[model samples]
Every structure is written in C-alpha cells, then in structure tokens.
Target: MSETLSGQATSTISAVVGRADVLIVGGGLSGAMLAAQLLRLPGRRRILIVEPRAELGRGEAYSATELGHTLNGNAARMSVDPDNADDLTQWLEAFIAKGGWPESDQQHVPVSELFPPRGIFGLYVQQRLAEAREQGAVSGSTAEHVCGEAVDLHIDSSGARLTLADGQCLEGAYAVLATGMFPAARTRQKHSSGLNAAAIDPWDVAAMSRLDPQGTVLIIGSGLTMVDAVVSLEQAGHRGPIRVFSRHGLLPHVRRQPPAWEDFLAADQSIRSPRQLLREVRRQCAAALASGIDWQAPLDTVRAHIGRLWSQASDVQRRQFVRHVRPWWESHHHRSPPLSAELVERLYKEGRLTIEAASLKGLDEPRDGRVSISIRPRGESRARTVTGEALINSTGIEYDWRRVDRPLPQQLLARGLIRPGPLALGIAADPGGAVVDAEGDVSTRLFAMGPPLRGMWWESTAVTDVASQAKALAVRLAQLMDSQKGRG
Candidate 1:
C-alpha cells in the first residue's frame, strides 16, 4: 500500500504521502550525491528526493540520449566522493573488466583517458546512487525517490511543506533546493512575426531529425551547446552547412593534459579582486610557457581557489568581472574534449561549418520553409540577412532566477522565500548552501546547493565543486536533523 503523513488531503490528486528528515527538491547529480553522502553518515534519517524525471542522476546536462554527447572531464576527476578523487577511475576499471562497454567502443579509446558518453556517465551516477540507497537500507536509514515536480514550498515554525505538481504535499524537517541549471530563455525577437515556428531547442534530436538533411542550420551562441548541436547533426547524418554566431565567436579551447604548476596563491591568499588575480595569473602563465609547460597549468591551479576569490571579491568587482572577463574566462576554462574539437575543426576545414562574431538583430518570418535572420557583424554597422531551415538557440544555461520561467522559481520569488544572489547570478545562498530570504535572513528550514549556489561559488557547476558542496551540506543537514530529533 501507500504511506501517509498526518496532513489533510485538500485535493483528489493525493494526500501528504510521507515525512522525511531531509527533502531534496532535485534528483540530478547534485541531489543524488548529497543523498549518497547523507546515507553514508551515521544516522537513520529518511531522505526523500523529488524529481520529475524517471531516473535520479541524469539531469538536463547528462540526460542527452545521443552517443556523441560525452563528458568534458576524464573519469579520474569526475568522482562523486571528493575525498576519493579516483573513485570513478576505479569504478570504471571494474566496469570495463566486467564488460560494461561493448568491445568495439572499448578498443577505440584508452579507458582511463576517455571522455565517456554522457549517457554512460549518467548510468554510473545512477549506479552509485542505487548503491548508496542499498547502504542506507542496511543502516536502517531509508531513501525514497519521489517521481514528481516540486511546484511550491511553504515553511512554518516546525518545518517546510512541498507541493508537487499533481497536488500531492510532502512535509519534511528540512528542504533543499537543488534545482540545477535552467534552460536559456528564448530571446524576445524585436519583430515577432512567424519566427516562432523557426526556433527549436538545440538538444531536441527529434526536431533536428525532422529538418531537411540538406538545409542549412543556423545555431546561435557558439559555445559548448553549439558543439553539442553540431555533433547531434553529424550523428543524424546531416551533411548541410551550419552557421554559428555569437557576440565573441569564441569556441572552447581543446582540453589537454597539463602538468601541475606550483600553487603561488596557496601561501599568500591575499588576492581578492579579479584584476589583481588576473594579473598574477597572466604572470604565472608566461612563466609556465617559458618553462616549457602549457599555460593551462597555471590556470588549472586557480581552480582550487576560485570559490575563495569569488567570495572575497566586492560586489562591484564581481560585476566588473562578469561584464569584462566572463567571455574569455569561459572559453579558456571550460574546454571542449579533444575529439569533439577535432570534429569541429574538420568540419570547418571542409567548409561545412561557419562561425561568425556578430550580434543577432532580429528574426524575420519564415519564407516558404527557411527562416531569415538579420545580424550585424562585429565592428560593422551594416546588417546582413541569412536564411536557414531551422534556428537552434545554444545560448547556454540561464542562471538568473528572476528570468527563469519555471513554476517553482516563480512561486518562490512570489513568496519572497528566496532572493537573487550576487550580481543576480543565481539564487541567494550562504557559503554553507543555506538559502537567504529577501529580508537578508538565513533560512533554517530551507537550503540549496549545485548551480543555484553559483553566486557563492563561481565554479559550482562542475562535479568536483558540486561533490564537495554536497558532502559539506550533507554533514550540516545531518547535524540539524540530529538536533531536531534530540529536541523531539
């Protein structure tokens, strides 16, 4: 049968089904990792992860069904456990030994160095979560996966109540908003004629497949998502030309193995401003290059200190960095896998792909079948028109909560339960992942992690960043639960 909590059922959809010590609002990697960490700790608390997806680990980024979509980082650095950095590498070795991958795929790349498919990584995450769930069962702590979207949240003196889209309610001692990256909002075209029918989601493979194989494709914002779109086209046997446009026309640098450089900032730890930090980084890069090392070595060293640097920077400095340095930093820091870069290079050399630095003016109505795009090339005032069978917006993830069209975020903003973080990057959160309300009060019943904590940690989206945050948040939440139990 079904479990029930001590709350009244207001609708026929369902009653308040159950209660948990910790209620997680997302089931992506961040939520899964947090749940896993909590399960490992000494406790018998119940954890309920509410997610709309059928599986827990495959969030938007890793949920791609395409074989060409692969992880940007290697297995050694992608482990869920921050303490055991090589856990994924070890797991991958055993997986290969047990014939986890097909022989044909295994022979093509070295397992340790391979950028495995996103789908495979998703499976690995699901497997880890499943194992953690089993461990929780053995420890008398229970973790339940609730398949539903959290539409609204209400907090009271005792705890917080979550309302699902289907009208079911769940009450928990504590709630975590682990909602990860939101899709980039559609650009409001100046001339909103028939352009609506021309734009399609970049990741929608079915929609891409429906396009004429020979028709030109116009992709907006040439970054990682643009690469994914190109790969998807190639996988679908698309042979037509592709034109990609963005403000900077910057493509991600190819990922390369770099030796560890000395941590110059580790001892000093005084650099707070982005300008000061960038100056030091440039100096180190030059020194590394002089010493026959890739410049990436010095930049890689900065990864460990990004959170501290971001936290210490003044709001004005932070805004300056976003306005001036974000584009270059993104292109250099978030690199493309070598294989994908090579594919893009090959296509460019063959004249099948064109990348341009330009600003999108507006989209004209679809004439016959193709859509017309008006763009002003960088440094040129004259506008030119280009026609494509379809347009895909690869502008990347939207971080500002205020602009997100999701129901949960909208409701949260309406209730003043959360506020915008620094520079309106994401949801307001403290260093420890606790949500801060509009009145600048720390939330006792509500917390957050993952991408929503980006304002607190500039590099929070990566697995390493998320894993460390998850571990720390899990420990903190466990302590809170213990105190609540003691009071009871």
Candidate 2:
C-alpha cells in the first residue's frame, strides 16, 4: 500500500477515449447547477455529466423518500443564483400556485408540510436544464447525461482524460468534481451478526425505516440527520421511544424566525488565524447573547468567512482547528429546521426521546431476538448495556475523499493527476476548482468543487455558498472550452 499521497502507476491507462467541451463528474446539486450555469454561455459547448446514479439533484441530501425530510435551511436561501434573492422561492411559489396549494410567506415550514419532495427537487433542477436547452441557452449544443462512475482522471498537455467504470473514457477541456458525501462508517458489531441490520449512512433511508416502530431505535449521532430521522419516524407513525447518543449529546440549534445580523462577520480584515478567529467569534457570540440577538446570527458571520479563514491558516493551524473546534463549530453553524427542533423537544418532553453522552463500547447479540448495545461513560470503567431492536448510525458522511472506497480517486492519485489539499481537507485544486497535479501544479483541465474542497474552502457545503462556486466555475469552464474550440 502506498503511504504517500501520490504514487507510481503500474496499470495501463485506457485507450478508448472520447471528447467533450465540458465533463462534470457528479450529477448532484453542485454538478447540475454548474451545468445550468454552463447553458447560459453564448456558444454551443457539448457538456457531458458523468453520474453513476440514475437521478440528479437527488444527492444524499435531497434523495430521501420521506416527506418529513425538510430542508434545514429556508427555501429562500437555497436559490441557485446568489444574486437572485428569491429564485427558489419564486420557482416554488409558481409551482405551488400552479398546483393551487395554499400560499403563505412563512420562513420555516414543518417536515410534515406538503412541500416539494427531494425527488421533486431533482425534477425541478432537471426541468431547469431542459428549459435552458429549449431557450437556446446552448444553441445546438448537445448535453449528454451518461450514467457511469468516473474512476480515474488522466491530465495531460492537451486536456484531461476521464476513465469510467465500464472502460468507456471521456476527455474534456474542463471537469468538475462534485462527488458529495460518501457512506458513513459501518459498526463493527454488525459485522459478526447476520440478523441485525442497520443503516450507518444518511443515504440509506430505506434500511433505516425498516426498524420496528414499537422497539427502541438508537441514533448514533445527534445532528441534522438525527433530527431528520426523528421527523421521518414520527411521520411513519413510529410511536416507539428514540434514543440519541453522542459525545456532546447536543442537538443542533434551530434557525430563528427572522434572520438577524446578516452582516455580523463582515470584518475589516479576513486574515485572522484560527485561534484569533475563534476568540473573535466567542466575543461576537457573547455580544449577541447580551444584545438579544440569536447566537446563530454571529455564527453565520463566522461561516461566511470560514473559507477565507481556512485558506489563511497553515497546515498545523488547520489541523488544530479540525481536531479541537470542528464539532462545536458544526453544531452551531449547521442548525436544524425550527419544526424539527420542536419535534425533538416534544419527543423529549413526552419521554419518547433520550439523549446520552456515553461512549459506545460495542454491540452484543444475545440468544434472544433483541440486540444489546454496550456503552461506557467518559470517565468510568464500567460499561452499561442497552437492548434495542435497531441502531442507526447518523454519524454524517466520510468527508475525506481520499479514504473513499471508489477506484477513480485512487487511480487519479496513482497517476499524479490530482493531489489532496493541505491538512487533508479535500482534493487539492486551484481557486477555480482546477485539479492540482502531484508535482504541486494545477492542471489546465481537471477541476473540483463542493465538499471536496472543504479543506481549501471550509464553507462550500451550503447551497448559498456552493451556488456561487458553481456559477463562477461554469463561467470559467465555458470560457476555457470556447478558447479551445476557437484554436481547434
């Protein structure tokens, strides 16, 4: 096994290569939005999106079948256009008005509310692409959606080469890596038992919903996913008690009714280190508490500048920040929907929900039907056991793409086509999302964005932030493709 980030290649590169003006590697929200933005370009550029999944926009976040899985952020904040403040709302309203649904401009909506399902969100995004095509956004420009996984990328002087899992290859002047969250870590306890099945990843909602409603369901993590699961279970008429366990045992804070102090983090200088940044944030948090402003206000400020702050930090500083402050920061910034918050509170008040701060020891499968889970306290040597019918590991996604079990990233690293960022944040790429080579050089064609750049740009996950990146990347890729065609 290669211990280093980059390694020598023993395998031969693929020979059956095709070409395109632009090749987007993932068809999730970021990739689709980038494709939409590309349609706005003047010339006809053949755009190809390599998405292994059959559906687009229904990434891990929007792919849930549960109607109770509402967006944590407001609909107004999820617009593809950062410039257009009411893009999603306008679209949603038009859609709702056409469907003759009740119209209210309320900020927060419940998970039970009959708004657009995530699959519908996928349809809306795909429809936008179709509308763009009909409007001559890319006149005579062909847009192909190939259902395949891009396993390897080959960067050269001419362009970048993409190797699909089926041995089909695609070459493009530019590429976007928008692979969202990967599957979470599977529990070691489940490895031995053949009967007890559980979902450790957010994307595996079907498996999660299979748990008995009368039996106790244990959620391994307490964050957005936990809250989402609670809403889903309740909607499914799951009257059983829900138990959530984590190190901190703190649920995510909720979004306020009216957004307050939108410009709190607009500081004079954006070059502060992580320590200084945390100090300043605490100061603002204290001030917000004193001034009757919600703590989320000042936290949002820090989030806005997280990219700049992360970029400015040294490798050591970034590692320290991740080790010491990431969880607390995430709990504050990535909040739950107000409705979900209320549901969790209601569950707790009714004794249907219990939060624990003990360390999970292991899983014990008894001769009986139930599964007993062992847990030990932080400071105690004694381990206590709880028997539950099911366990759901809502411990979020594996953010580190290098650790991803897929073959493409591994092949790319072997070929020196891409390198990871400092502090293993994500794949190393230039500011424009161009993939950097192993020799510490930016490739002319290969690019990446979304959570893959979390190391470089810490705040790229939210729709508000990613939309800008997508727009900018699309504009640049369009220009690059046009320039290449002009030369050809």
**Top TM-score prediction, candidate number:** 1
For all predictions, the C-alpha RMSD in Å is 3.1, 6.5
Candidate 1: where is the Cα deviation over 4 Å? 1-16, 103-110, 185-197
Q: In order, what lDDT does every prediction score?
A: 0.83, 0.70
lDDT of 1 at 213: 90
lDDT of prediction 1: 0.83
Candidate achieving the largest lDDT? 1
Residues 198-286, model 2: lDDT tens digits: 34344455555676768788777788878877877777667898888887777788766434665545645854777777887888778
Q: Which ten-residue region of model 1 has the weakest summed lDDT?
A: 1-10
lDDT (Cα, tens digit) per residue for candidate 1, span 1-488:
12222123436433334677889999899998999989888979788888888778888877878767878887776887788888887777777778875642644656667777788788888888888877887878866777788999998778899998877888899999989988562433323343434677666777778788989999888888888888888877788999999999998988887888899889667777888888999999999999899999998888899888888888999988888888988999888877788889999999999999998888876688778899899999999998898898787777888877678988999999999998888888888988999899899999999999888878889888888998999999999888887898
Show the colliding residue pairs in model 1: none
Question: Where does the lowest 10-residue lDDT sum fall in candidate 2?
Answer: 1-10
